[model samples]
Target chain A: MIAEKLVQTYKVSFDQNNQELALAGSMRPQRAAEMADCVKLLETSLASIRGTFYVNVKRLVRLNNVAFHSLAGALLKAAEERPDIKITIITSSVIGWSTKKFGTLTAKNPKIVVEEYDSEFYPGQAFLEEGGFVPVLRTQTKLTWKHERAILPRHGLEPGMTMADICCGIGDFAVLVAKEFSPSRIVALDHSKSSLAYARQVASEFDIGGIEYIYGDAAEMLLEDGQFDFVSCRHALQIFNKPEMIVNELVRICKPGGRVYVTNEKISQCLGEPRGPSIEWTYEQLSKLFADFDMDLEFGPKSYQALQRAGLEDLRIESFMVTNRDGDAQAFADMIMAWEEMFAGGMSEKRGDDAAFVEKFRRGFEDHIAAALHPGGYAGWPVWVASGRKPR
Target chain B: MDLGAGQTEAGEFTLLLEFDMDMAGFTSNWSYCDRLSTYFARMISHNRSDSLLYSNLFSSALNELLETVYRLHAPTGSFVCSVSRNGAKDRIALTIPVDTETEGFYRDAVVVLNGGDVSPRYHNALFSDGPLQPNIGLLELAVDYAACFSIEPADGNAIRLIAELTLEASAP
Candidate 1:
C-alpha cells in the first residue's frame, strides 16, 4: 500500500512539474499531455490510499505564472477525484498576485489551510506581502536546505534518539531531525502558541511523523524521569529570563548517560561587547541552584561557558558560524526583512529605541554577509553548542 | 696722633632700655617679624663702636635668622630677638620671626655670641665664630622689639631677608 501511494505521489509530482515546464515555455504540448496522462493513471491507482499531498504551487508561479496555474489546476483536480486522499497546499500570501481563480480553491478543501509564514525569501511581514510568490518559495527552499544541512550530521543526531527542542521556532530543526535522522520521538516545545500551531501545520503538511508539538514553558513541563536519551535547547536559551532553571530542567529530562546539548549565540561576541547584564553574573547566580547536582559545566570559546561550578562533568564545547545568505537581490532583501522582525521582537523588551536598534542590527547583518561572501569575510556570528552528560 | 697712648681708663658702660609693660599683651599685639625687626634696629643703633657697615651686617644677619626661625618654628604671635657680644670687642645680632597662626608654648629665647678676628676665645666657644649662647636679656630685647618696631605679619607668607650688610672690620 505504501508503494502504491508512493507511485501515485511520484506521478502527481511529475505531472505537476511537466505542466509547469510547458507553461514556463520549456515543454511542448505533446510532452505536457503525456505527463498529464501518466499522472491520471497513478491518481486512479492511488485513489484508495489515505494521506495528504502538499505542494507549494506558489513556487512555480514565479518561474511561470501559467505553469503555476496549470499545476494548481491539476492538484485541485486530483484532490476532487480522490476524496479519500486529503491534499493541502501552502504558500506565502505574498504570492496573492496570480489569477483570482487560485484563491477560489480556498473553499474546496476546508482542510487545505493557506498560511503566510515568515519565509527566508521574504523575512518581514511587509516583504512577505509585497515580493510576490517566487521570492517566498526561494526563501523557504533556502531555509529548508540550510536547516537540513545543519541538522543532518550523524554526529548531531541518530536513529532512536529522543530529543527535546525548546523554543523550537516553527520547528525548522525539529522537522529536519524528524525527516533526516528518523529519531524515535521528538518533543518540539515552544512557549509561543502561534508558533507551535504553525509548526504543527507545517509538520502535517510535510507528512513529518514522530514529532510531538507541545506548547508551554518547556522548563515548567515535567518529564518522566530518565525518559529521554538526548535533550537539546537551541536559539531559545538566551530568551529565557532565567536560563539556569531551563538548563536544570534539560538536565532533569535526560537519563543517566544521556547527552544534553544546548546552543545559543553568545550575544557578547555578536555585539562586540557586553550589552546587557553580564552572562557571568547570571551564570554565577544560577550555579548556586545546581550546586547539589553532580555535573560539570564547560564553556566553549566565544562566550560558550560550561557551568563548572554547577558540578556538570565531562563537558564538551564546540563552535559553529551561522550565516544567512540568499543568492540574489530579492532574496537578500527578504532576509533583511526577516532579521529585522527577529531583532525588533527580540529586543523590544529591553531599553532603547527599538526601531533604531533593528536598523543597526540589519546593517550589521548585511555587513557580515558581505564579508562572508567575499574571500576574506571569515568573521561570522558564532554559535556555541555545548553538551554534558549526566553521570550514570 | 695719639691713639690712647696715655693710660686713660674708660668706665664699663652698659645700655639698658627698660619699660613697664605686659609681655603677653605686647606679643599678642605685635607680629614675630615686627619684634625681630625692632630688636635688630636697636642692636644696630646702640652698638656705636661698630662701623655703620658692620651694624648693617648685624641687622641683615638678624633679619635672615628671623626668617629662618619663622620657617622652622612658626610660633603663634611670638618672636625671638638676640644679641651677641665678643667680650666687649665685637658685636653680633640675630632675630627670629614666628607665625601667629601656629599654636604652641613660646620657649625661652637663645642668644649666641661669636667673635670675628677680634676674639679667638669667642670663635672657640661657638666652634665656628658664630654665637652659641642663650641669654634671658635677649628675651627682654625680643619683647622690647615687639613693642617698638613695625613688621608686616608673617601670616602664611613666605619668609624673606629684607636687608643685608657685608662689612670687614678689624678688632677695635
Candidate 2:
C-alpha cells in the first residue's frame, strides 16, 4: 500500500505538577517514526519526575501496534534508566482495550503498574448504587416517567426512532421507553456496574427484550458517530462537573438530522406548601451541599444554554414540575424521605454540618414529606427537559 | 496435500462476513486495515456480552492481520478476507496472492505461533529497534489474544491463512 498516513487525531499533554502524561483520541500511526515526537516528549517528561510518573490514557479509544511499540520502548527505557521511580498507567475500563493493552507492561517491569480508574469516580454517589438507591431510583423513574412520557413527544421522541440513553442510571426509563415507543433499538449505558446489573435483572425478570444495557462512561463513549436517531442523557448533567464534554459526545453520536435530549434538576426550586419556608431553606442548603461535591443542583435552567452552545439547531426546551398530586401521594412522600436520608443523613455528615444545622435541614425534608401526604397540601420537584437537533 | 504448519481442512463453517477486492484496490491505502476491521468488529460484536469490549479486541486482532497482509502481499491478485463462526470460536481466513518467499514467511510464522511459548519472543519483537519482525503480528495474536493459527493451500500462487479465536472468557 502507498500513501497510508492517517490523520493525526490524538493529543498528548504533560502536566508537570502532577507528573502526568495524558493521551486521548484515536492513535493509529502507520510507522513508529510517526510517534517520534511523542516518544521524545515522554522521554523528556520522565527525566523531570523523581517518582511515580503518571500516564493517563482514559480517553484514548484506538491504539495500533506501531504506536504501542514506540510507547512501550520509551516506558521500558525509563524503567531501566530510573531504578527508583515507579510508572503508573491509569486506564479507563470504559475504553475496553486500555487495561488489557497497558496491563501487559507490568509483566516486564514491576514498577510499571496499570490501574483501571473506575468504581470510585463519582464522589458521593457510590453508596447509593451499593444498595438502597436502586429501588429508590426505580421509584424515582416511576414518578418522573409520568411527566416525561408526555413531555418526550414534544421534545422530538417518537416511535421507531433508534435511541440511546446515556448515563441511564437503573435503566428504568429505557425500559419504559422501549415498552411505550417501540424504538427500533435502544442502547442504555451507565457507568455503575451494579446499576447496570440491576437494570439487566429488571429487563430479564420482566421478559423484556430489544434493550441493550451496557457499562460505559458518559464523558468518553466508544459508540460510533451518527448511530442513533435520538440520544438522551437524563438527570446526568447535574452530577457531572463538566457537562459540556458529555453534551458533545451526545451530539456526536446523533445523526445530523437527529436530536439530543437531556433532563436536569433545579433542586432549589423544589416547593412544598404548609411550612414552605422550612422546605425552601433546606433545598437552598441542598444546592450548596451538592456544590461541595462539584455538582450543580441548579443545572436544570442551564440546559437551554448548554444545548445552544453545542451547535445544535431547532432547539426545544421546557420544564415539568412533578408534584405529589400527579399520581400516588405516598410515592412522592417516600422519594422525599429517601432524599432526606441521602442528603442530610449521608452528605450533610460528610460536610460536617453541626447538629443545629443538620436538625433544620432534616426538618425541611420532613416538612416536604408531611405536605405530600397532607391531602390538602402540595409538594413539588421541578425538572427541565431540553432537546436540540444536530444540524443537517 | 502438504498439511504443513498445523494445516488442516477447517470443515464446514458459517460465514459472518467476507470482503473481496482487487489486490491493488485493497492495498492502495493502508487505512483499509483500520476501516475494515473497525466496521467488521462493530457489526458482529453487538450480541457479545460486552459489545464495546469485544469490538475493541476483535478490531485490534483483525487489524494486525490486515496490516501484515497489506505489508507483505504480492504485486497483483485478489485479496480476500472472510469471517466465519463455529459455536464460540470465531475464525478469520485471509487468501493472499504471494510469491515463494512470502509463502515461506507465512509457513514459518505458523510454526513459531504453534511453537511452545511466544511471550518472550513477542515482547522482544515489540521492543526491538529498526525494522519489525515480519511475523510479529502473528506472534502477538498467538501470545496476547491466544489465537490458534493454521495454514492451507489455495488456488495457484495463493495461500489461505486462518486464525481461530475464543476471545472472551465465560463470566463468573
Candidate 3:
C-alpha cells in the first residue's frame, strides 16, 4: 500500500539486467498482507524473465520474515509452478544476515539457490589478485605516486572535494590523496577482498581517517550517483575489458562540473635504454598476450576517445613517464622486477605460452630492470592521465 | 522474547543509548520500528571493525525486537529502548508496557527459544502455510543473529526485554 507522502522507505525494481530484480532499503512491513504490491510485482516480473530468475538482494539492507516469506515464498511458488525456471537469490556478504537467511529457501527446493556476490565479483583481474601480487601492487603505487601527486592538481583535484578511487588497488593512492589534498571523503573501491583488507590495515597503520575501502566490481558498481566532486580511477581502465563502461560510470557518479580523472598504461611505449630492442619485442608480445585475456595494455592513448565517447567535456589528456631518473631508481627497478615475475612467472603461464616465448618475455623485463638499475641508463613506464568534466 | 525473565547486573555493561517516548506516539505508525532501529544501529556501529556491515546486521536484529513489541504490547505507557556494550557484545534492551496476554506471549516464546534449536522452527515459521507467527522475530534473533535473550520486570506494568549479540566480525 502506498502511503500519503511516499513509501520511500524501500524500493523493489525489476532491473531487466540478467533478469535481476533489485530490492533495497529497510523492508519491515507489519504483516504478509502489507507486501501484496511487492508480491504481485515480483510474480508478474517472473513471467517475462528467462529460464533463470535472479533476485538481487545485494543491496537489500533490511528484510523481515514477513517481507522475506512473501517475496521468497512467491519465488518458491514460481519454482514449483514453473519447473522450467530456476530461481536464484543473489546475496551480498557485506550484509551478514542476507546469505544465511536467503539460503534457507534452497532447502525447500533444489531449483531455488542463494549465491554470495563477492566470490565471483572480479572478472579478468585474477592475475593481479594473487596473494603474492599484493606487495607488488603497493610497490607499483609507491612508484607511481611520485608522478600522480603532481599530476592530480592539473586534473581538477582540490582540497575538501569528495573523490572515489575506482579499482583502487590496495588504496595507497586514496591515502595519499586524503593526506595531501584532505578530501572530505574518499570511497576507495576494488573488487578483491584481500586487497581491500590490506588497504584497511594500511590506513589503520597510518592512523588516517576518511578513506572508505569498499569491495566492488568497477563495471557494475554499487556506488550511488552524482555523489562525488572528483573521481580518479588510476591505472584501472586498461585492465578491464570495457574501459568505456567504467568511464561512463566515472561520469555518472561525478557531479556536474566535477572532473573524472583516469590513468592507464601504454605498455609498448614503456621504453628502456639498455637492451632496447629486446624490451620492445617483449612489451609488444605482452600487449598481444593481454589482448588474449580481454585486457587492454595499450589503452593509454585511447583514454581520450573513451572519455569523449562517454560524452564528458573540457577533456584534458596527457602522459607521464615514471622513469628511473625521476625519484627512487631502486624502487622503480623493484617495480619492474615484480612486473617481470608476475608477467612471466604468473600470467604468461596462465596464457599457456611456450618456454621460448616466456623466456623471451622474461628477457625483456630483465633488460628493463637492468636499464632502471644502470647508473647512466634510463627506463620509463609511460602512463596516460586524462580528465573530463561532467557537463553542467 | 526478552520479556519477564531476569535482571542484568548494572555495572557489567556500559550504556550507549537510551530513547524514551510515549507508547501511543511510538506505535502510531508501523514505520517507527524501522526508523528507530536504523538510528540506533548507526549511532552504535561507528567503532565496529566494519561499521556498515555491523550496522546492517544490528539494525535487522533490533528491528525484529522492536516489531515484536509493536505488535504485542499494551496501548499506553512509556516505551524505553536502550543499548549497552561489554567488550564485543552489544545489548538491546527494550522496556515496554505489557498486558497479561502479551506478557504470556513473551514468556512462552522465551521458553520455546531456550528449549531447542530455533533454526528449523524459524524456517518452518518462515514458510508456514498458516497465518504468520507472532514469535517469528524471537526465533529470528535466536537463530540468524545468534542473539541471547533475557527479560526482567521493570518499573510499574513494564517488562524489560533484552537481546545481547556479538555482531562484529572482530572488536573495533
Q: Which candidate leads in DockQ?
A: 3
Model 1 Cα lDDT, one tens digit per residue, A61-172: 2211222234445556666676666554444322222222234355544544444331332122222233233243345435434543554342245677887776666666
Clashes of 1: 21
- For A1-392, candidate 3 gives per-residue lDDT tens digits of 12243233578889776788888876888878989988988988998987888888887878987888887778888998997899889888766788988888888888999998776765567778878888777878888888889989999999999988888888888988998999987888777877878888888998977677765667766555687999989888998887878888888989998999998898998889988999899899889888988889999999998998898989999998889998789988888888888888888999898999899999999999999899889999999999999998
Ranking by DockQ: 3, 2, 1
Name the 10 consecutive residues with the lowest summed lDDT in model 3 chain B.
Answer: B1-10
Which one wins by lDDT: 2 or 3? 2
Judge candidate 2 at residue B86 and give its lDDT: 74
Each prediction's Cα lDDT score?
0.41, 0.86, 0.83
Candidate 1's TM-score: 0.36
Q: Can you tell me which runs of candidate 1 are displaced by over 4 Å?
A: A1-156, A268-310, A324-337, A341-366, A369-379, B1-172
lDDT of 2 by residue, A1-392 (tens): 11234332789999999999999877877788899999999999999998799999988877887889889989988998899899999998766667877887898888899998874667466766766877778778999999999999988899999999999988899999999999998999888878887887888899888787777778888786798999999999999999999999999999999999999999999999999999999999999999998899899989999999999999989999989999788999989999999889988998999999999999999999999999699999999999999998
TM-score of each: 0.36, 0.86, 0.87
Worst 10 residues of 2 chain A by lDDT: A1-10
- Give lDDT tens digits, candidate 1, residues B1-172: 0011122222232222212122233344323333433344333333332222233333333433343343344443333232323233322222223443322212212212211122233222222222222221222122212111212233343222111122223101
Determine the iRMS, in angstroms, of model 3: 6.0
For model 2 the local lDDT of residue B154 reads: 84
